[model samples]
Target chain A: MLALDIKHLNKKYEHFQLKDVSFQLEKGYIMGFIGANGAGKTTTIKSILNLIHKDSGEIYILGKEMLEHELELKQEIGSAFGDINFYTRNKIKTLTNVIKKFYRNWNDDAYYNYLKRFNLNENKKIAELSTGMKVKYSLAIALSHGAKLLILDEPTSGLDPVARDNLLDIFQELVEDGEISILFSTHITTDLEKCADYITFIDNGQIINSSEKEEFIDTYRLVNGKEEQMDSIKDQLIAYKKNSFGFTGLIHTKDFDPSWDIKSALPNLEEIMIYFSKKENLHV
Target chain B: MYNLLMKELKLGVNPFFYIMPFLTGALMLIPSWLYFLVLLYFCFLTIPNMFAGYKTQNDLIFTSMLPVTKKDIVKAKVSVIVILELMHILIAMIYGMISVRLYPNLIYLFFKPSFGFWGLCFVMIAIFNLIFISMYYKTAYKYGAATVVSITATILFAGCAEWLGIQNSFVSNLFKGAGTEHLTTHLFILIAGIMIFAIFTIIAYRIAIKRFEKVEI
Candidate 1:
């Protein structure tokens, strides 16, 4: 069964609109939601969590409608944003005591275990923790409640490389049991390369692609050719950058012709995103 | 709902606020000063600071993250305000009784600390809550304008009531002169005030919930 299924979700603001956003995440896997800043990634995640009201949509988590059963469904869904710093003066122990009471499935043992595992001190004030520790604390709270689905927005935005890698490792280990599913959104594509099982790309409030990690990357190819050779496949290229010697561009693998006598190679997640961003600037 | 209330009392409110009622209630012992300002201290100090704390600490977002409905959130916050208001009034009432006993024969310029006076205090706070809660939830994050407007409305209520007590002979007689001797009248006003408090607070809660539901967290 799908852990999350969003169908035709739409939310409009005075300045921007999310149009026909749809995606699915199967159980026991991590789907990385990738997009540039202000590309509607946060808006989509907020819509799914019901933090913002959607104009129209159907969101199902674990076979239950989100709006109809929000409280019940929230009991099973865990969410953490990278930027939230809560009640700085309150000790973690105090905060946890208040939060744990809301969940019927709260496990104290699991909570204490995560505290030890994450090296979080119960007596420390929230302000004392580093950014990385704060995210870990959020994760600890989320996991202690036996949540079946986790939705994270920009979870790795402001961490050092080592810290980011540590979080990525923790994320992979959490899904090993095949019972918990995660939908993590981040602009940092390199982090996703380490652990994301599926990649969902969004741009300009629209879904560019959503598929398995390898297949999604393989769908696009980066090609390099001389200025003269560019004319042959220029129209087919998604976007290209020209250097003094030649031009490098991105193209759909399906549209790439073998007889074009150009050098083409598989693109990384970052390369795909960069080219997609440049597509807006590409003039006819 | 109980858990949500606990969250507000424990995390949202400071310990100093819990002790503030006792400190401020001491004002009622001043031997017939303006007793309305005694409870007015709550409107002046506790509420503005408490809500400012919620805004700075981002309590709404934190509470929203929990497994509760939008309605429950409004209910819990309103309940906390009521709880605090009751604590201030009850503690001050004890002081009020003591002041009245200490000077039974003392003539008063303002309303004495009687059951009827306590009833007026309740109505004042009710108007404050009705204005504050309804306006604050429109944004659910910004409390400054709401705080200013509501406090002004409450002070206006208190000012008008005191004016009536002084200018109108029947009002002065009821509260300060022969009216103080009427137990049935005091009881009736007290009961009416309590009912108004409940009804107005429920209306505020309903209005707050509707506005908060439309707010995007």
Candidate 2:
């Protein structure tokens, strides 16, 4: 079963629009939503959560139509953004008490367990917690509600490397039983490279690609060659950068011709993003 | 819906606001003061501060992320406002009764703290809610313009009503003169004011829901 399905999702602001955005995340897996800032990642996430009304589209979560069953569907989906700072003066316990009342399946045992695992003290005010702890607190609340799918937007943006790795481990553990699915949005491609089973890349308000992580990486090549060899594949390159030794460029694996004799290797997620961003700037 | 209301009361409101009514309600004890200012304190202080807290705390985004609808979100907020408004008015009414008992022989200069006058206070708050709730939901985050406009409307309503009581003999008779002595007339005006309060608040709730639905966050 698909945990989430967004079809033709479109939301327009004065200067930006999510154009025909579509993707699906299978249940029991983690899908990385990748895009740079203002590339419609948050906008798409908000649309799926119904925080912003889509101009036109359909969103389905856990096989239920999102708009028609928003409240019910929301019960099965937990979402967190790394930047969310809520009620700074309120203690964690106070906020949790308020949150627990809204969910029908809220599990005290699970809630307490997560608190213990995260090392979150109930008495600490939101203002007292560091950014990583805040993210953990949000995850605790989300997981306690028996959510089947978690949608996280930039959940690792402000964390240290150790904290980021710890969160990635927790994410991997959550989906091990095939009962939970995650759709995590972040520009931190390294985190996705660590745990993401699937990848969906968006650039300039449109979906560039969505597929399994290995296939996604396999689709692009990072080609390096001497300056003399650049002209043969210049038109086929997505974008290229000049280095001290030679020139390096990004190309679709299918576009690479072996006869051209350009040294090429599979591109990493960061390389893909950098090339895509360069491609955008080149047009502008 | 009930849980959402509880969330508002528990997390959204400051504990200081819960106690503010009693402190401000004591103002009614002063003899022949512009009693309108007693309830006006709520309009001036509570609404603005509570909304500012919501804005600063990012309450709207947090609430929207919960398993609730936008309509329920607006409904819960409106319920909180009504609850606080009622607390202010009811507490002040108690102090007003005590003041009237303490100064029984004193001739009142403005509208006395009578049932009819209490009814007018309800209408004033109703006007405040109508303006504040409807306007605030247009953005669902910014409350300064809404608070200013609504408080100004409430003050104008109070000032105009009080001015009419002093200048118009018939208006004065209805609230202060013979009307105060007659339980039926005071009851009628009180009921009328309560009805208006109910109607206007519901209208405001409806308008707020409409405006808030269109809000992005």
- Fnat (0 to 1) per candidate: 0.77, 0.91
Tens-digit lDDT string for candidate 2 (B2-109): 999999999999999999999999999898889999999998999889999999999999999898888899999999999999999999999999998998886777
What tens-digit string does per-residue lDDT give for candidate 1 at B1-217? Answer: 9999999999999999999999999998897698899998998899989998998898977888889999999999999999999999999999888889988888888998878888898899999999999999999988888889989998899899889999999998888887898888898888889999999999999999999999999
| Model 1 segments more than 4 A misplaced | none
Per-residue C-alpha lDDT of model 2 across residues A1-284, encoded as one tens digit per residue: 99999999988899999999999999999999999998999999999999998999899999999999988988988899888798989999999999999999999999999999999999999999988899899989989999999999999999999999999999999999999999999999999999999999999999999999999999999999999888877899999998887899999989988888878898999999999999989999
True contacts kept of 2: 0.91
DockQ of each: 0.80, 0.86
**What are the lDDT scores of the predictions, listed in order?**
0.92, 0.93
At residue A273, give the lDDT of candidate 2. Answer: 95
CA lDDT for candidate 2? 0.93
**In candidate 1, how many clashes are counted?**
0
